[model samples]
Target: MAAPLDLDQLQTFIAIADTGSFTRAADEVFRTQSAVSMQMRRLEERVGKQLFEKEGRTNRLTEDGERLLAYARRMMRLNREALSALDDNRLEGSIRIGTPDDYADRFLPEIMARFSRSNPRVELSVLCEPTVNLVELIRRGQLDIAIVTHDDEKSPSEVVRREPLLWVTSANHMVHEEQVLPLAVGRPTCLWRQATLDALDRVEREHRILFTSWSATVIIASVLAGLAVAVLPECALRPGMRVLTESEGFPPLPDGRIGILRGHSSQPEIVEALARHIAESLDNISLPAPEDTASFDFAAMNLAVRGRRHKPGQMAGW
Candidate 1:
């Protein structure tokens, strides 16, 4: 009889593919780099095919690996659902969740739907707020968990995904060619807003804030009306919006790290379960490709912008 594929190995394989580095995958799975490599070798032998190929410094999935990814994801999701359904301890507690409106619209609905189906008895209380406020709420124990965007890479949270920031405008808008670049931005506390200002400053670009709002809808509407360009996560770009690349003379913006921040107190089992579901759901998100541009030195940008702060009205004319 042949040996069946191991679930742990499958999970490790998926982690490597998601993170794009064996070292990062090892960190994710709580295994040493050598152990991750050995598991990958074992998985390849079990499947009788090479699952990955080296592309520069990163590992690219092979044809067989690409085919297996869908199956692996489905299998893992089903396995988790079965475990939750069969467990005798029915979860019954309310979980307070917070996230920025932009992310809440794009990702939370699906995550909540899956969690609701699995743990029908648990009640979910959700709030849409800025990431800065969400982090503070989590610290104050007002929220059980929060999905937030962090500018710091060393944040002590579970990083679900990282996406490059892009300067976006409406498809028919030619605002990028204006002498004084107009920006429709979020509140001053927004990481995207800070990164956008820093990037523009690095290139000595003259810009002015034409509109400010915490609502993604309002910001997008301003862009669509040709009022201004906005900085946003690549995943948040909609169909009618076009990303501005280096060719358009826009400087590169920093990548945004989406992560889960849990409250300090011991969480209820239901909250933990929901957090796990949220992480898995975010890992499965497929963001569109960012604008094609030459790579900018993120390390230098970080160093240069360190300690620089912008107030609400400070960005009048620059």
Candidate 2:
């Protein structure tokens, strides 16, 4: 009989697939690179197929690996659910999570859904705010955990991922061609806003803020309506937006680092659980391709806008 697949190995496989790098996968799974490699070798031997192909310095999933990825995710999800169901000491506590509006839309639902399934008794109070404010809230013990963008590598928070900051504009609008560039910006405390201003200043590019709001929905709307261009994290680039490259007369903005900050260390178990879920969920979010020109759904955008407008302080909750 074939050797049975191990859930641990399958989990590592999913991590490798999500991160696209064995080194990053090792970091995510808390294993050494050699150990991860050995596990993959053992897994492939058990399956009787090579699962990965070398592509430059990165590992690309082979046909067998691609087929196994879906099964691995499903199995892992079930495994987690089974474990949670079997645990006697179910986690119960109120967790205050703060995140930027843009990230809230993309990552909050999955994190909350998974966390809710695992800890049904837990109540989550989510706050959507700028990273600067989130940091302050976490410091003041108003928030149990917060995900923020950091430009420094030496920050005390746990770095989740690093992505480029892009100049975003409406696909149908030629806002970049204007004499004085119109901009949709976040508050002054926002890192994206500061970075956008700094980059433009360095290039001596003339620009004016046409719209300013803490709500990402408003910023996105301004861009979508062809009212202004905005600087945003690459992951926040929706379907209707076009990314302005450095070659297109836009200076390169600094990369944005997404990290998690913990408030009080009292609820270590609950905080750690939520943090792990956030990190894993973030890993699974696929970024838009640079050349993708897909038309965004206006219905979804309108809903998001309304959601942001009504609940300015809160992005999502369960």
Candidate 3:
């Protein structure tokens, strides 16, 4: 029989995957670089697969590595659950948290579920609003914690996740080819809205805001209906959408940086636990592989869009 995988080794492997470098993984795992390499060697040998390959200056996961990453993360999560379940110093308190719906849709389910399972008696109050509003609430001590779009130069916080922010259009739409591009975007104060407008201006593109809202659902609905193009972080992407590339005359936008902001109202222990859960949940979310325009079924999506006469428009917030 194959040797059972070591949790320690699996952890090191996960660190390497998360950090994308042996050196950084070593620091994260509190092991020497050589020790980290040795752990991986044994792990690869036990799994009977080469888990990593060199890509340029950094190491990239091989196909087998990616496959193992999913299982490894699950194992680690289960281990955490087991420990939490057995802990005697159980925490109990109501905590209020906030995040923009853009992230709330993709992130909150796992976070809330896991945290609740671990701390059954703790009450959770969740509010979904724009990051701008969420930040104000955090400052006013109206929320215990908040997840916000991290702007390092502006409102810096503990960044928990990062992904590409892409310009996107309906997979089967010709709206992207319009001389005057129509956009479905966030309200004026939204960082993503500013980024998209700035990028368009830098390229000297003529664009008009056809729809504006704080809710990601509304922006996505407009894109799906083929009414306008929009920009979204990778996690917020949905089917029937295609990423626009620089080759397609769409300028690159800034990275989407998600951060955690803690307020003074909640107990430190409660707030910290939720913050940790948020970071872990975001870490486990699998990013879709690089944009592939050919991957979406154009005809099917086009027919689906044409079959619908109207789509729900954006809401002011959340």
lDDT of each: 0.76, 0.77, 0.81
Per-prediction TM-score to the true structure, in the order listed: 0.76, 0.76, 0.80
Q: Compared with the true structure, what per-residue lDDT tens digits does model 3 show for residues 44-125?
A: 9999999999988788899999889889888888888778877888788899999998788888888999998888878999
lDDT-superior candidate, 1 or 3: 3
Better of 1 and 2 by lDDT: 2
Best by the lDDT measure: 3
Cα distance off (Å), candidate 3, residue 139: 1.1
Candidate 3: residue 116 lDDT (0-100):
88
Which should have the higher TM-score, number 1 or number 3?
3
- CA RMSD of all predictions: 8.5, 7.9, 7.5
Per-residue CA lDDT of candidate 2, range 176-229, in tens? 789999999888777778888888999999999999998889998999899999
Worst 10 residues of 3 by lDDT: 307-316
